[model samples]
Every structure is written in C-alpha cells, then in structure tokens.
Target: MHQERLTKLRNASPAVLPSLLQCDFGDLRSEVERLQAAGIRALHLDVMDGHFVPNLTYGMPIVAGLRKLTDLPLDVHLMISDPAAYVDDFAAAGADMLTFHIEAVPEPAQLIQQIHSHGIVAGVALNPQTPMEALSGCLDQVDAVLVMSVNAGFGGQAFDPEAVQRLQQLRQSHPELLLEVDGGIKPETIGPCHQAGCDLFVVGSAIFGQDDYAAAVRQLRDAL
Candidate 1:
C-alpha cells in the first residue's frame, strides 16, 4: 500500500515533504494533521544521533508515537552513524521509507538489502560535500537518493548551489528514480531545485515557521 502511494508521489513532480524538525513538539499531532490537510503527501523525519551530525534529534519512540498520529508515510532520514544497527528498530517503529547516509554505512548495499528484508522502501543519502561517485554502483539497489542541499546536522542553513548540479547529474543518470532534495528548501529555492530535476522537496522552516501553514505549503506547491 505504501509503495503504491510512494510511486504516485515519485511520479508527481515537485512533491513537498515538510520536515518535522521545525514543528513544535508540544503540538506535533496538530502540525502533522494540518500539513496533511494542506496536501502534504509524506513527512520527512530526521533522526540524528549527536555522534554522526553533531546534533541529537528524535528517536524511534517518537516515530512509534507519530505512526499512530497520522496515516501519511513517515520518510525517516537517519543522519546517524551505525545505521545498520538501527534499521530493524526503525522499520519496526513504523518508518515507511528509511534513508541512511552512505558515509555512515560501510556497505550501503547490505543496508539496503536489510531495509528491504524488513518490508519497507530503502534510500541512500549524500551529504553536500559527499561526491556523486559515492552513489555509483549502488543506485539500482535503493528506492531513492536524497541530495542534501546543506550540511545535515543543523536546520535553517543556506542551500548550497552546487547541489543543483548534483541533482542534474543524478536525474540524467537515473531518470525514473526518486530524487529528493532536503535542507534550505523554500519558495525561492524550490524552483531551482525542481529545475535541477528534484521531484521531492523536503521543506522545514518555510512551512512550520509560518502562521499560515497551509498557505505556505500552497506557495511551494505552486512554485513547482
């Protein structure tokens, strides 16, 4: 069921995935409901373990709780080291699609296979500084590729213009695969990312930081 929905989202160019990182946890359920009502197809959950990205974000318990809150797909991004150890846990916790950093995992194919074995979609992420070659020989093994437009540790950072070129390169090579761009995705920057062939745009402050969340989402959706 989730895979079919994901396929539709992948084909629907410029799908906006609001990052829950900027939302107020005190009102998380409402925030998620609001985004869904505003036409968001998926939620991008960033799981950071201070060791990998110098930031400690939410864990699997939060994911388990969120799973019961909304029916939207939980696209969990593991920006932590030793992702292999936690793939089973995140999958059990209700992550519909689990994306781990290529830099963190010694063998990405093994991790992708592990995620698939758990009955969920798998994706690989490349940090802004990480070269495209890192994803070579492995694109066919994963469901998607997350192109980080800014450093992964923190939120509210500026988008790196170089990501545009990377997106173009990946799109050219894997034309049918899902290509997502995260970090610093706003109304102004989304157009450039979309032009670079990014179909999934993971937005943070641009949506949650606004008083009119639905309107903010509409602005991004219309931008594409």
Candidate 2:
C-alpha cells in the first residue's frame, strides 16, 4: 500500500503539497476540500514539539482528523526530539509518509527502518544550517529527503539560497531520491528550487494566505 502511494506521488513529480499548518483549522475539512478542488496531490503536516523547535503544532488527533477528511497522501513532518517513539502512532493515525529531522536522531538509519516497518515511506530532513554531509550514511537508505529552505519551526520565513545548493548536491549524488523543499516556497523562490532539483514543494502561506486558493495554486504551478 505504501509503495503504491509512493509510486503515485512519483508519477506526479514536482507536486505541490499545501501545508496544513497555515490552513484554517477551524474549518479543516473545507480547507482540504478547497485544496483538493485546487488540484493538490498531497497534504503536508508539520508536527513540532516545543523542545525541539520552540513551537508546538498538532499531533495524532489532527493527523487522524485529516485522515478522516481526505484520501490525499498525508506527508507528516516530525520536527521533534524523539520521532522514533511516535512512528507507530503517526502511522496508525494514517500518515502515508513520515519524515523526521536528521539532527534530532542519533540512529537515523534505525529510525528510518522503524518508519518503514510501519509500512510507510520514511524521509530524513535537514535544517538550513545542517551540512549535507550529516546525511552521508543514511542518504541512500531512505525514500525521501526534505531540505529545509528556512528554519524548521516557523511558518513564514524567507527562503535560504543555500537550500538550492543542498538540493543540487543531493540530486547530483542520488538522482532517484525524492527531494522535498519546505518553508518559504512562494512563486518567486519555488522556481529556482524546482530547477535545482526539488520533486515536491511544501507550501504554506503562499496558498493559505491568499483569497482564492485555486488561483494561488495555479499561480505557483505557472511559476514552476
């Protein structure tokens, strides 16, 4: 099942995944409906623990809630201190993919195996300041790698030009890996990231902050 979903995502290469963190949680179902109508292929969920990133976002309940709302792939980003402990919980909550911060894990390969054990795609994420060398041992083992364009915790930060370099390096080294870019992914910055080698763009404010979600998505796609 997980492989099928991953294949579906790969088929829609360079897909736009609207971040739910910026959506109207008061009316989440409608927000999801709007995104689906706007032609989104997946949804990105940011789960942050206060200790790891100085911010607290939603947890399993929200994941489950979104699971109940739509069948679109749930790409859950775990920005926490200990993601291995929550692997089963998030997978049970219906996450199709679970990406944990490489900086937070001592045994990234083990954690990646743990996430895969749950029958879901596992990804490793690196913060803007983290060197690409940090992912050396586990790069080829995981299904995806999320290159943070900005710091992890916040929602509306500026895109870091360094992230494009990181994406390029990863693409050059591992051409088959799914490269995802998150944070500061508006029309102006997204094109360069895509050119550099990003298979998935996790956009937040660019779509949610707009009056017309469909138009916002179309504009971003046009930029790509």
Candidate 3:
C-alpha cells in the first residue's frame, strides 16, 4: 500500500467514486479505465450475498478481474451474512479497503482485526434503519464508516433524509474518521452530505448513466 496515495485520498477535498454497479460489466475494463481517466482514484465495489441483502452481486472473482485492469484502490463493501468467512479472500482478490455491515457481524472489533490482519483498511457500514449503537465500542476499530443513504441491495434508489442525521452524528462524534455516504448520491444530495462532513462520496447511476463520464465526474467534483 502506498501511504501517500491513501493519505491523499483521505485528505482530498472530497473523493468522488462512481460505483461499478451501474457500469457495463460486459466491458468492465473499459468502463473502469474511463472512470480512471475521469480522475477517480478509487473504485467502490458492492458485494452482496442473496441472503443478507435481497440481491446477489459481484464477488471475489470479479474483484480479482478488476484488479488486473485498474491501478485504482478497490473499496469493497461486503453485504453478506458471514463476512468473517471471506475477508481474506476478498483481500487476496486485491481489495484495498474492505467494509462490512455492522448488521451482519456481532463482534465488529474482531472482524476489524481480521480485516487488518490481511493488511487492508477495514470499514464498518450501517444501513438506513440500523442504529449507531450497533457500532458500539468499535468506532475506533475501523478505517471508515459507510453510511448507507438508501436501503442496501440495490442501486439508484432515492436518498433517505434520515441518513443526513446519521451523517451528522458520525461527523460530530468522529471528526477524524473517514466518513463515506453511498446510495442515491447525486449533484443534489452531495452538497448536504458534504456539509455534514462526509469526505468520500459514492455516486452510482448519476455518473455511470450518463453519456460523458468525465463531465459527470466533473459535475460531482464541482458540487463539492
């Protein structure tokens, strides 16, 4: 891991990453390259297991394939039942940072340690309805906090207003934490999140759904 790049990413005015869920997976490499050219430093890969979340999405195989294509850091968000069972595999698959749902794991500290043991950054995620209490005693245990602005398991859903309060709480309490807001993040919602102190923004369809990737990314950056 390059500490400088990680530091730059964390300290960036606001890091905007376009989620690959809305991309054309048939030509994933080209799409990722396009995103890179558009000034994206990291890629957000949402890993969903049919049981934890309603939908099933990408896994280690696709992550590994993506690793072979881009040099950008891979931020793999694991929305699965037993994340502990597969952290090492995802790390081996070239994940630069691994985030698992607090709703899925009981002892977040142990899982955080497990993820760090693989020499990758560890993050904890909270769904829209899940309380911050679920993150008790573990706020200091992870590298980032992924605040799901919409229900998990799907992309392009509308932003939930309750997430703004959640972001406020996390920001006020952990000012140094790498705060990230995902789901339904667009030019309209990014401002609220940025004002709430979120530095890492994940834009899905708002960027990938467009004809010009660079222009879309510029709009997101300009909003911040």
Candidate 4:
C-alpha cells in the first residue's frame, strides 16, 4: 500500500522543484507562498539540532505556522539525535512525509512503525559516512531513503562524487523503494542522480538563496 502511494506521487504532474527545501525560516508564510507559486509541488523541511548535525532549526511553531502557508505537501527530515521523541509532535504539526536518520534513533524500525501509526509516509535517512547496508532489514517499512551527499547540519556544501556509485548500489538493491538525494543537489548534479535512480531531489540553498526563487526551480527542473 505504501509502495502504491509513492508511485502515485512519482507520477504526479511534472513541474519545477518537485522537492524544494525551505531552510530560511524568515517570513515563513511568504516563502512558502513563493515556493508554491514557483511551481514547487513538495516542500522539504530540514529539522536539525546542535547535537546530531551542529545546527539548530525550528520546531513545532514553525511547522504549525507553515501548515497554513500552502496546501503543498510537506517533507520533514529530522536531523536530531532523538528522532522518536518528536515523532508525534511533527505528525501533529502536519508533515505529510517524515524521514529520520537511520543512525540517530535507537529503534529505527519501531520509529518507522510509530510514524506509520500517525498516518504519514515514514522514511529513513543515511548520512554520508553511513553505509548503505545500514538500511538492511528495514527496507520494507520505509517509504523512501534519503542519502545525504553532504555532511548534514548546513547547506551549500559540495556534492560528493562518491555518492553516485553508492546511489547506484541502492537502486540495484531496492527497485521498489523511492530513493531521495539531498544536500548540495545543484542543477548539473541532478541528471546523474536521476540516472542513478534517485526519484526525489532535495535542493536547499540552491533554490532558497537564489536571486529569483522561481527561476532557480525552473533551472533545476529543466536541467534535469
């Protein structure tokens, strides 16, 4: 059933920035509106903490506020140490897709189960240093796998060349699973990622920090 749902999202209307990362919390409503107007179908929310990733991002208030900004789907990625502790909060905050790192939580499979219980798509994120094999026995419950190309915590980092081969390996092992690529996902790198079987592309500073947000989305989409 989860697989079927993911397939539906993949086949949705093609447009600019299928995955638009909203890192700048400044004027949350305005930014969300601009992203939606720019033809971004899905919004990627990066949740961080000073612990796991050396960064501190907003929590429930931002999520609650952004919920009213646009009707577009929200993709929440938790880069915190204790992911399960905030599962219910994020779920109640209106996240359509919740992805927590596989290496952070104590019981990842159980966390996925709890996320599912909340009626949202549950996904797992693997850091740049983490092996792809870490997702081994827990693939079935996951709706997606977020492979971090840069060390998490901040944006605008270089896209790792080694990630390409690793992405290919993930594609080979899990054809049914939706693979997502995050961190430093610029226009030129998108093609190879798609070719390597990454269905979802999460771009943060590439779009948010641009002169024209809408144009950035178009450039990323057209390049891919």
Q: For every model shown, what is its TM-score relative to the native structure?
A: 0.95, 0.98, 0.95, 0.90
Regions of candidate 3 where Cα sits further than 4 Å from its true position: 1-8
User: Tens digit of lDDT per residue, candidate 4, span 47-155?
Assistant: 8888998888777777777788766667788989998899899888988778898888635778888888877888888878887778886887788888889888866
Query: Tens-digit lDDT track for model 3 on 1-224?
Result: 53444565686648897788878999997998899889888889999999999999979999999999987878898999999999989989998888999888867888888888877888899989887898877898777899999988975578997888888999899887888999889898998899998888988888988999999999988888
Better of 2 and 3 by lDDT: 2
Off by over 4 Å in 1: 1-5
lDDT of 2 at 210: 98
**Ranked by lDDT, top first:** 2, 1, 3, 4
Residue 91 local lDDT, model 2: 92
State model 1's lDDT. Answer: 0.87
- Candidate achieving higher TM-score, 2 or 4: 2
**Local distance difference test values of all predictions, in order:** 0.87, 0.91, 0.86, 0.76
Question: What stretches of model 2 exceed 4 Å from their correct place?
Answer: none
Model 4 stretches astray by more than 4 angstroms: 1-8, 12-24
* Pairs in steric clash, model 4: none
lDDT of 2: 0.91
How many collisions between residues are there in candidate 1? 0
The most accurate candidate by TM-score is 2
Candidate 2, position 105, lDDT: 89
TM-score for candidate 1 = 0.95
Residue 171 of model 2, lDDT score: 93
